[model samples]
Target: MFLHLGGSTVISLKGVIGIFDYSLTKTNHVNNYFNNGKKIIKICEDDEFKSFIITNKEIYLSPIAANTLKKRINSQNFTEKVNILQEHPTFK
Candidate 1:
């Protein structure tokens, strides 16, 4: 599973730790954490900040909303449940 983080940055969903909405929080700590140029991958086409994804590898600044990203991630679970149901004799 891969999540498209706006630009050409598509990362493995398995590696993602969390998806956060930038608008909801006023955490200067998080902003400070991204300082020093560790690697802030900007995927937002507009200057507007949307959400951010934290991974084991890097932090991503995405144009997609947190809710949207969450849906994408949870879609994996929905697919798995559908597959399980399909495999059951009762479902068949």
Candidate 2:
């Protein structure tokens, strides 16, 4: 499954490591680390991101809230489980 961060930015959930709240990255160490990295991708145009999505390839600044992103992940997992269950020989 894929997660729409913002704008035209969409990433695969399989590569995602963690989703962190924006405020959590406000510390000097966190801010400096992310800001200095060239691999950091900001999804929104402005500095109004709500969360940080750390993936295998790069770090993404998403406009969506952390809680909301977690919910999306859970929803995807639930859908996959449902599909698996339906495909089981016992269910058929």
**Which has the greatest TM-score?**
2
Tens digits of per-residue lDDT, candidate 1, 22-91, equal 6533455565666746666777654666887777778787887777776776766633311111022321
Q: Return the top candidate by lDDT.
A: 2
TM-score (all chains, Cα) for each model? 0.69, 0.71
Model 1 segments more than 4 A misplaced = 78-92
For candidate 2, write residues 1-92 as lDDT tens digits: 88778789888877776677777674665667676654988888557888888777798888888878777768777343211110223212
Candidate 1, RMSD to the unseen true structure? 11.5
TM-score of 2: 0.71
| Steric clashes per prediction | 0, 0
